[model samples]
Target: MHSFSTAVLALAASATVVLGHGHIRRVVVAGQTYPGFERWANTDQSNDVTWSFTTDNEGPIEAANVNTADIICHQNAKNAPKSVPVAAGSSLQVVRFNTQGGFEHPGPEMHYLASCGDSGCANVEKTSLRFFKIYEKGLVKGGMADDPDWNMQKWATTEVHKNVQPEGEGFIDTYTVHIPADIKPGNYVLRHEVMGLHRAHLGEAEFYPQCVNLEISGSGSQQPNGVNPMEMYHASDPGVALDIWVDLESYKIPGPAVSSVASKRDIESSPTLKTHARDIKHWLSKFMA
Candidate 1:
């Protein structure tokens, strides 16, 4: 399972509203959480549970000196490194996306929403698009092959990223939700929703989910720090260098590729590889064009 770790901050409000696909199709999308309501109790609570990740950046990367990020997180099961466990008062794993501030001011803030959306349930918390992609697209497999819906993300974050985080300005965001004195203890999925726009009327700017998970217990169940809980983020861009062999070489692609094969080096630089540097340049040029 892919996970992240960070400490808890204070909780103030619950993020609200629905994604307004305009159609309430019961397509079973997971990881969409909002404040006030959460779909509590895992009646089935499948231990058969498995986790996967996807990000804008899914490749070999160094932890310093870069900014253009990949945000994508499918560190494959084999590719995923074993990290410390998440518990109350320890460094918890949280996957977050930086709001480019392309949208309007006071956008949706980032929060560690519990496991359900209001429409989805009364006791559950909000979920994330990252998690949704996992459900809808299936574990981002096959050597950095891009998910078709990866395109949907452009519509949400791109516009808002303009005003807030901009090319240089540091992004400011807020997350909503509390563990509630009654929240059950155990490993639960949490989202790190980040935003700058607040006006619900200006489209769905306030509802995007840039999130991660948590294993809450003890003090973790208490109210979090209102904002900025000592977070350290990494660019999701795959172009950055790294130390791990797979991370440094095999971008975040999972499984094998098309009816073909090659040496490890060849696999790392295949024709289909989603090289982040190339992706950024191509995308930038296309935008400029």
Candidate 2:
């Protein structure tokens, strides 16, 4: 009986790893926090239209599958409806959670945006979407607190690290990116991704990516071009199949370089804006629950 119970417990733990990894469950837009995949799955899009709800598991994608079609937007984001409305020049904060615990993975965080039409979220083909990077957070010097640049990230410095510390007991989870004010008005999808390096020692880096649908309102005409979805990252890319445990100081960030079409200072200087980048406590209360 003891052996049987042990087997049963093992099976349950495996199931949780397969079905309950992590996902973006909350987003903050203009200081208002809105429920993401979790809440939307029950109330707004009950039919499992969003990939976050219908995916077989929230487990991280294996590095070998980085080039597969699944890499485009992960499981079922293609048909997910645009669930949120955001304005240009606004800072959007994405919050991720694990079913078993808080974010426990350690690696870089990335944010990308793709333009679709006014109602394009309801029916977007993965291939038809092109993405441009708006925010990225990579490891600092040696990833140790003693390192001079320890808390100084190469990108997304203020927003991503505001809630969590790098390599802390809990996963450094929250990330923020600004919607370019110069972007043309339309519906867009925000693609957020986190690369987990805990298992990178085995050449099996894990990728957690989710797409958030939104309607963006703004006035600018510079639509940025992006690489083909299939060509975004290669399985052999240093960033994809890496061993983060070995190299502490010489790690190079994987994937395409960050591209921004707007100046970040503009967001902070807008006369009508009430809060700027240093508003750390704004998003803390919402995620406390």
Candidate 3:
């Protein structure tokens, strides 16, 4: 009896650790889903576009490290060796994994793009990359209520499999962003980030950033100016350090304004688009040709 009780307690503790954090599981480009680096497995992903991280456990780069290179991606991030072809003005989906639940932290999601130039993003210098904000969403509705949908977390991190029972089956959440139609074709690094501000009032905002290599193909020729990734946010920035628990009128998202060339979608009215893998493959072949 004593041993069984100990085993149950141990299982609960393990479950807590797994449910505490989340990571990217895969990315869908032009309807084709590419697997993200499996940090938990630490497997070889030489052909994958998502950058690899050193640790198996998913964690955030604290706000204190905002000025460091670790903030650009996660800790000890390695650039991907390949880039995936994505057409301009197409939707890119990022699927997140939490094992048994949705992303519990409330915050905003922001996407940036850094041109890798003629050399490409596969081996580009991490510090030399200049990133411009392409998309940002925060505080969909302003109010002082406990309504989950009104908060940024619901807008960006809601659970997709709420009906799945037995806990850990299909715990996935998806966020989509469209490539700007007018941007020039080139190799670019897509930086997708989510800021968890639950502890911001306590001076410990969390940043989860991941990078993907993309070869954009299009005839558009507008390249927006970018800022150094390290300079994108400061510890004291109003958006970086703020309390979301109290009655709030509005919340500002950190970083530069959305680029002029970005494909703007209305979060309030736009329905989440879904695509078939077969159709995506057909379209991609013609687009690349």
Candidate that would win on lDDT: 3
Q: Mind sharing the TM-score for model 3?
A: 0.79
Best by TM-score: 3
Listed in order, each prediction's TM-score against the native is: 0.25, 0.70, 0.79
Candidate lDDT (C-alpha), each: 0.25, 0.59, 0.72
Two-way TM-score contest, 1 vs 3, winner:
3
Which residue ranges in model 3 land beyond 4 Å of their true spot?
1-20, 145-155, 158-170, 266-289
Better of 1 and 3 by lDDT: 3
lDDT of 1 by residue, 1-289 (tens): 1112100100101131221111000111124321111013244322211122332221221223112122221122111111112334333222222233222222212223233222222222221221211110111122211112222222122223332322333232222233333333444444333332222122222222222334445543323222111122333322112111111213232211311111122122332244556678899999999
Q: Residue 119, candidate 3: how far off, in angstroms?
A: 2.3
Write the residue-wise lDDT of candidate 3 on 107-135 in tens digits.
Answer: 67889999987777987988988998888
Deviation in angstroms for 227 in model 2?
1.6
Ranking by lDDT: 3, 2, 1
lDDT of candidate 1 vs native? 0.25
Off by over 4 Å in 1: 1-104, 107-178, 194-206, 219-289
